[model samples]
Target: MSSFEPKIVTFLCNWCSYGAADLAGVSRFQYPPNMRVIRVPCSGRISPKMILAALRKGADGVWISGCHPGDCHYIEGNYYARRKFTLLKEMLEFNGIEPGRLHFSWISSAEGVKFAEVANKVIDEVRQLGPAKVFIKESPEESAA
Candidate 1:
């Protein structure tokens, strides 16, 4: 039988990580297509509720990507995202969520190669950890049904 394809949700900053991902595609850098990319104006826009929503929607892994330090178009958006992700990591752990289910990284618009590398690496890590089933929340409709 074939291996399972883990569903990954990636939040990419429009100014950086999203461009890098676009570059990766233009450069023909091959990577798995298991990820659903969500383009945000800044990584800082990724709220905890959005992250939880992805998991609740059946995503097996989540990735948050932003500009490299000091390269954010919004000046300090990435810094805030970094800090928020750090706190989110701790909160997830406190709730018994596996740390491996979430990842954060910096990718610049010029780093097409880096984007592919990070994509493959994250995929590998999630694969090794298997599908994330813990901490999944039931939707209100599902609960009612």
Candidate 2:
């Protein structure tokens, strides 16, 4: 019932999380209508810059869901994602962004109910943290003092 519905950018792996999301929709499993999904070939393909860009683009939070480490379609994609996720957490914290604003999970294509549950959880966590303060750059002239 809160008006502060956080806008979340969600990255899903094509072979796993993406399918789960689709299933969730088809099954009518409901979660908060806060996330905008971007399905990628694999979670390993998601770069830190991409995540940072989403935050810069005004997303209140980000959620990345991929195949379980051993179940990755691309063999080791999710493993790499986990590594990148750790680095990204440190970077976000250094940049003054709360680590809670970002979330990650491993989801197989069949777990539609789990997908919905995680979605709701992510939205709730972000909502509790309030809106993210996006990074803004000053104009060249403004910085020329």
Candidate 3:
């Protein structure tokens, strides 16, 4: 097959990671255009269902980025996010999702360079995994046929 370009679903905490992504853009840092970002009020708001939905919708990978521990604008939000991410990641892996298909990170608005770096890393890893197979939802017509 031709070279694969994986589709990525990215969840960014509005106060931190989202700002960092915007900063990376303004700084002209280059990264792959493979990600579709969803901005959330805080990382703590992310649910396992959301991640699964992305995968089911045919995303090859998913990434969640939020404020560093102890630095959440919502005060303790990232703490909750950390625990949820840990457990959800493990569960997804146990359920047959490849370990490399999910990623998590902490990035502040001033860390534009770091944001670019992480973006590149995430894209590279997912590309290596090729197209997603499991849990992908077929279109209605395709399924009906």
Candidate 4:
């Protein structure tokens, strides 16, 4: 109920998490409405720049969801995503971004309940972290020495 409803940007695989999220909606599974989901062909399509872009665009947190490592629609797409996200996580932390501000999960197309659960969990964690002020861009004057 806080004024800071953290903006969560979720990149979901079209064949899995995206379908699962649609199922969650149809099931009327209650979840935080703060997530702005972007459906992609595969999680492998997600890039570090994409995640950082979402944060720069006002996302308080970011998530990338896909099929299980061995279940990616594009053979090993999820595996690739996993590796990329792992390295990106470390880079974000080293760059002054909070480590907890980004996350990743795997959800099958049939797991409507899981989609709702993950969505709620991500929102809760972000809420505890408060607003993503650090992710916000500073104006020219603010960044000026």
Q: For each candidate, C-alpha RMSD in Å?
A: 2.8, 4.1, 4.0, 4.3
Residue-wise C-alpha lDDT for candidate 3, range 85-126, written one tens digit per residue: 899889878888888999999999889999999999999998
TM-score of candidate 3 relative to the true fold: 0.91
Please, what are the lDDT tens digits per residue for candidate 2 over residues 59-109? 999999999879998889899999999998998899889999999999999
Weakest lDDT window of 10 consecutive positions for candidate 2? 136-145
Q: How many clashes (backbone N, Cα, C below 3 Å) per candidate?
A: 0, 0, 0, 0
Give residue 14's lDDT in candidate 2 (0 to 100).
Answer: 96
Off by over 4 Å in 1: 136-145
Give TM-scores for every candidate, taking all chains together and pairing residue i with residue i.
Answer: 0.91, 0.91, 0.91, 0.90
Model 4 lDDT tens row, 16-132: 999999999999999988988898999999977778778887788998999987888799999999999999999888888888899899999999999999999998998988887
Question: Could you say which candidate leads in lDDT?
Answer: 2
Error of 1 at 143 (Å): 10
Q: Which stretches of candidate 3 lie over 4 Å from their true place?
A: 136-145
Where does candidate 1 have its weakest 10-residue lDDT segment? 134-143
lDDT preference between candidates 1 and 2, better one: 2
Native-to-model Cα distance after best TM-score fit, residue 2 in candidate 1, in Å = 6.5
